[model samples]
Target: MVSSSPQTLILSRILTQNEAQPEAEAVLVEAGRVVAVGRREDMQAQFPKADTLDHRDLILTPGLCDAHIHLVAYGFSLTQLQLYGARSVAEIAARVGQRAANTPIGTWIQGGGFLMSELGLNDYPTAEMLDSVSLHHPVLLYSRDLHLAWANSLALRLAGVNENTPDPLSGRIVRPLGTLLENAAELVARAVPAPSGAQTLAAARAGANDLAARGYVSAHTMAYEGPEAPRALQTLAAQGELPLRIWACLPHQRLPEAAELLKTNSELFEFGGLKFFADGALGSRTAWLHPPGFADGSGTGIALDSPELIAALGREALELGLVPVTHAIGDRANTEVLNVYDGLRALARQKGLRLRVEHAQHLRPGDIPRFAGLTVSAQPIHLQGDAAMIGALLPQHQRTSYAFKSFKAAGALLAFGSDAPVARPDVRASFAAAVTRVADNGVRLAPNEALSVEETLWAFTRGPALAAGWTDEGMIQAGARAAFTLWDQVGHQARALVF
Candidate 1:
C-alpha cells in the first residue's frame, strides 16, 4: 500500500529535470519504473488499458530527496519536547517543568532545538537554569545546531561529568558542568537509556512515514546514530514497510566493522559512504576557524578529525568502494578537508566515486573552486536560522556562508538537505531560504547568493541523486524509477505521489 508499483498512467504537468525533454503531460509506470512520458493523448493511445489517475492540475516532478538526515533521531524528536522556537530560557524551563510534572520522577527528559543566541544568553547556559524546574529528574536539552548539549545537574551527576573530568579530544566539557560540546556530549548521552528494539523500529517507521508525507521518496541518513537504527530501516525494507529509499553511512570509527559487514549498493537500502567530521558547528562556537576566529573573540573552534586521519580512513573507505563524506562547516575545516581530498581525488576518480562534503557551510573564497566535481551536501533551510549567527560570529566569512550559488557556479553538485532535528525537513522552507535568502528575523543574508528556483529544485532532486550515485532517481524520464512528488506549485504544498 505504500507504493503503487503496478502498471498505471499518471496524467499531469510533469517537470522532468532532464534538460533534453523538460516538460511532459503524462507518465506511464510499470513495475515501479517509468515506461513512457509524453503528451496524455499519446500515453492513452499506447496504454489504453492501463489504470489512469487524473492529476492535470498538479505539478509533478521527481520525488524530493533529503540528502542528509538522522532519520531515526528525527522520528524520535517528533514526540520529544520542542524547543525550536523558544524565545527565552524561562520558556524552555517551563516546558521541561511541565514534562517532568507528568512523568515519573528520575526519568530523563530529553529534547533539543534551542539556540544560545535565540535564548538571549551571553554565556553558556548552566544546569542551574534547568535545575530550578526539574531538579529531581535529569534533563538534557541540545542546542539548535545539535553540536552542544545542556544538561541539568542531575543529568551531569548521573553521567559523572564533574569539573574534574578532562575534555575528550575534539570535544569540550564546558566549565561549570552544564554544556557539552562535540564528542563530549557522548559522555552524558551514553548515560541515558538507549531505546529498545521495538522503540527503534517505531521511530524508524515514524521517520520514513513523515518524510513520505512531506513528499520525500528518498533520504541519505547521516551516521550519527546507533547500529540498531540502520537495522530498523533494514527490517522495514524487508517487510516492505519502508516508503522511502535509504542511503546510509557508517561512522568513521566504525570503518572496521563496516568492512566486516560489507554492505553494498541496493535499490532500497545502501551503505555507500564512510562519514567523518573535520570540525563542529557554528552555533556551538566550535566550528574550526583560522585567525580572528569568532567575532566575539571566542578562539578558533575545535578541530575534530585531523587531515591525516581523514585521508587514511578515506583511502580505506575507497578500497571498500564507499564514498568519503566529511562534515566540514568552518573555513579552516573546509580547507583541511579539501587538502585531504586533494590527495584522494585520483583514487576516488579511479574508483568512479564522487567525494562528498557535508555542510560545507562556511568556505574561503579561494576554497570555493576546489569543490568543483565534489558533492556539497548542504542544508539551505539552515540559512533561515544561521543568517544572524553567521553575521554575528563569522562576519568575515559572511560572503561564503551557505553559498549555494557559488557551489553551483563552481560546478559542485549541490545536494540540499534539512539536517532535520537541527532544522525541520520542510521543502517549502528550503525553497524560501534558497530563493529569498531571507532569515527568520526578516533579514536577508547575502541576497546575492540566492539561487534560481529551477537551480534550487535540482539541488533538492538531481543533485542528491548524483551524490548517491542513483542514476534512475531524481528525474522523471523513460526508464527512470517511477517516484514523483505532486505539488500545487513549485514552492507550495506538496506530497509524495510515488508508484
Candidate 2:
C-alpha cells in the first residue's frame, strides 16, 4: 500500500495541464491526493513537517494513461518468444527452431508480431516452412496485427483443420495448411493449453506493474482476452497489488453475464464497456473496405460483427450502463460503426455515457466528421510499421489513415495508446509517430495528419481521462489524484510518481 502520510514534491517544473494553473514548481500531496500546487518556497513554508525529494532537473506532468491495451496479454508476450523484428523467414525459423530444440517434443510453441510484408512473402506462408524448423512441436506464430496466424502441420492437425474444413464465421483458413485470419485463428489458438489461474494473476500483476513503471497511472484494457484476464486484474486491485487503474471491457458475447454484474456506480476495477470488432486489420488483407479494395487483389476485407448485431448489442449495453467500444480498422468498418452509433447516440447521451471506437485506422472522407463527440481511441505508434502497408494496400485511403490532427479538428476526443502486445506501450515512440508521421522506411505518411507535441500530449493524458470519466486524474490540481509522470522533458524519458 502507498504511504498515506503527507508529503511535498519539489520539482523543476510541472506541466499541470490545468488551465487554472498551467505550471507549478511544487505540489503538496496527502493521502494520495494533491493538496496544493505552488512555488517551491511557498510549499516548503506551508508544509514544514512534510518530507521532500527534490528533482530540480525534471519536468512533471499528469500520469500517462494508455487508452487501449490488453494488459495480461502484454505480460504473457513479455515471456513469449519475440518475433516483432524478425527480418526474414530464416530469422523467424532460427528463433522457432531454437525454442523447439530446448523444449520437449509435442509442446505448443506460441509467439507472434511478424508482418507478412516484412517476411518478404508475396503470398501466405505454408506450414511446411514452419515444419522444417519444428517437426515435433505444434508451432503457431501470429502476424504483427494479431489478425492472422501461421501454424505448423502439427498445430493444424491438433485443431482438426484441413482443406475440407470450411472457414469459420467471419474468419478464414488460408489453405494448404498455414495461415488463419480473423476469427479463424481461434481454431488453432483454442487448441493451445490455457494458462493456469495463478499464471493469469501473475501476468496481470506483471503487466500492471510494467505500465506503472513506465509512467502510466491507468489503462483502458480492451477486450479480446479471456474472462480470467479481468478476474486477475480485479483480484490484484482487491488485494492492493494493482499499480495502475483499469477500465476493462467485456467481449460482446459475454454481455449477458456482464449485465448481471453491473452496478449503479463505477468501482476501482470497472467493467465499463462491451467490445466488438467491425472488421479485421489491414496487414491480414482482412480489413473490411469499400469498392476497389486492396491493390494486391484481396477483396474488401472480412466483416466480423454485422451492423444489426452492433445496434442491438449497443442499445442493450447502454441500457445496462456500459459503453459500446467497437473496433473499426477499415473505411467501410468505420462507416458501418458510425451508422450504428448514429442510432444509439440519444440513448448513450441519456445514460451519460460516451461512445468509443477503437483503431479508427482508416476512414472515409465523408465519415470522418461523424466521429465528433465520440471517443476515438487510436494508436499512433502503429503508423511506424503500417505506413508502407497503407501506401501499398490502400493508397486511396492514405490521407485519412492515422488522422490524429483531423480527428481532433473534427471535435472527436483523441485518446492515444500503444495497443501493447500488438505494439510496445512506449510513450516516446507514440509521441514520435504522432509528431513526425515518419514510417520505418524513412517515408512520411500523410504529414498533414501529424499532430503537434502539445496536442499529442493531450490525447495521451486529458483526452483519455475524459474518455474513461476520470475527473480526478489527467491533471495536477489541489483536488486531483496525486499521481504524476516525471519526464526528462515533455516527450523524453519518463517514470511514474504515485504519491
Candidate 3:
C-alpha cells in the first residue's frame, strides 16, 4: 500500500512550511527524501524518468506532528471505559456498574475522562458514591485533567489508603476517602497490576499507528508515562513497526538512567528532553496559583517540584545536550519557572539549548515578555474545556489564558499538541479552538489571543520540528523527508501520503 522508493508527485498546491520557498506545485523524491520542489511542469519535465504520482486535486503540506503526547498511556486508554461525556453521577455509576458486571470479582476496574464540574459536583466525588456500583470490585476513575482520582472504597482499601493515611509528598488523600490528588493518585495506581509486555507493545503500536493514520508523522512523547512506555516504543521502532517519529523525554529524577539511554539513538526515536513538573493541573484545583487562588476559597494551590531542584537538574540536562522542559499551568507556577529559566539563560545559551515551558496555560502580563526565545509547548484544544473553568476558578488570569498570539509576539516559539490521553489528538479541534478561541459553552475565552490558520499550522509543524532540533522535518524542501499530509482543506480532513 505504501512505497519505500523514490517517486515524483504532481500536487495541486504544496504549502512548504519553508519561508524561503513557501509554495510549490510539485516535488521530486529519491531514496524517500525530498530532492526538488518547483513548478509542476518543471518537475515533470526534469524528472521524466521517475515514476509520477498525480495528486493535483489535493493539497499537500508537511506531515502533522502532535508535539506533546503520552504514547503508551494513550494506547492503554483506547481500551479503557470512557467517561469523557458522562454528565451525572448516576450515568457514571451505570457505566461503572456495567463494567463491573463484565469484570471478574476483586479485579480492578479502571477508567477516566470525567470532570467534577461536569458531574455537577462542587467537590470531589466520595467513595460511597461509587462503593455500591462497583460491586465490591476496586474502581478508580480519573478526572479529565489526570490530576485527580476518584476511587471506590475497595480501590482505596486495596491501596491501603484511608482518612488516617498521611498524604504523600505534594499530594492529598482528599476527605471522605474517595479522591486522590496528584502524587496520592499514584498509590492506588501502583496497586493496579501493570500490563504485560505483550499488552505494552500492542498499546505502543496502537498509539503510534493511530497518530500516523491521522496524518501525524511525528510526536514529542512526554515523560509522564512509565519506563515500560518508552521501552515499548523503542521496541516498536527497532522492529520497524513504529510509523511515527518520536522525540521523547525523561523525568528529571531519571537523569541517572538518561545517560544510559542517550548512549544510543535512532531516526525514529531520540531522548531530547528532561521533564519537570512545577505544579499540577487546574481541573483538580491543584494548580499552584498566586494569592486568592480559587474563587471558591480553595486557597493557593499546591506546589509540586521545587525551583532549586529544577535549576540544578536543568543545568545537568543542558550539559547533557537535552532540553529542560517544565510543566507550568497556574500563573504562579509559570512565574516561578520563568524565574528559574532566567537564571539558566546564560548557561542555556552557552550550550545552545532552548528551555521549554509546557502548558504555559495561565500567565501574568509581566511573565509574557519573559517567554521570549523560549518554547511554549501549548495545547490549544485545552481551551474548549478549560475556558469556563478558567473563568470560574482563576478569574484574575482570564485575560492571559492560552495566550498563543501573545506568546508569539513575545518571541516564544509556539508548538501545539493535543496532550493525548488528557485530550483527544483532534487536529480539527486544535485548529478551531486556536483560531476561534471559542469554548464548549459558546463563550470565547480570549479572542484576542487567537492565531491565524497559517500561524496554527506553523505551531503544529515547523515550531515542533525546531523545538525538537529536527531541521529536516516540518517543511517541504530539498533534503527534507518525503513525508507529507494530504488534506481536503487546510485544517479539515487529512491523511498521510506514502512515497
lDDT of each: 0.91, 0.90, 0.89
Instruction: Please provide, for model 3 over 1-499, each residue's C-alpha lDDT reduced to its tens digit, 9 standing for 90 to 100.
Output: 2554456554569999988998999988877688999999888888887777777788899989899998889998888989997889999999999999998899888888888878888888899998888856999899888999999998888889988899999999999789999999998999999899999999999999898888888999998788989999999989988888899999888998888899767988999999999999888999998887888898778899999999999988998999999999999999999999999999888987789999999888889999999999999999998988888888898899999999999999999999989898998899999999999889998899999999999999899999998989999999998788888887888888745
Per-candidate clashes come to 0, 0, 0
Model 2 weakest 10-residue run by lDDT: 259-268
List TM-score per model, in order. Answer: 0.98, 0.98, 0.98
Off by over 4 Å in 1: 1-6
Q: What TM-score does model 3 achieve against the real structure?
A: 0.98
Q: What does the lDDT read for residue 183 in candidate 2? A: 92
RMSD of each: 1.2, 1.4, 1.1
**How far is 373's C-alpha from truth in model 1 (Å)?**
0.5
Q: What is the C-alpha lDDT profile of model 1 across 126-158, one tens digit per residue?
A: 888899899789998899889999999999999
For model 3, what is the alpha-carbon lDDT of residue 225?
83
Better of 1 and 3 by lDDT: 1
- Candidate 1 has its poorest 10 consecutive residues by lDDT at 1-10
Better of 1 and 2 by lDDT: 1
- Which digits, one per residue and each the tens of the lDDT, describe model 2 over residues 409-474? 899999999999999999889999999999998999999998988888888888898898889989
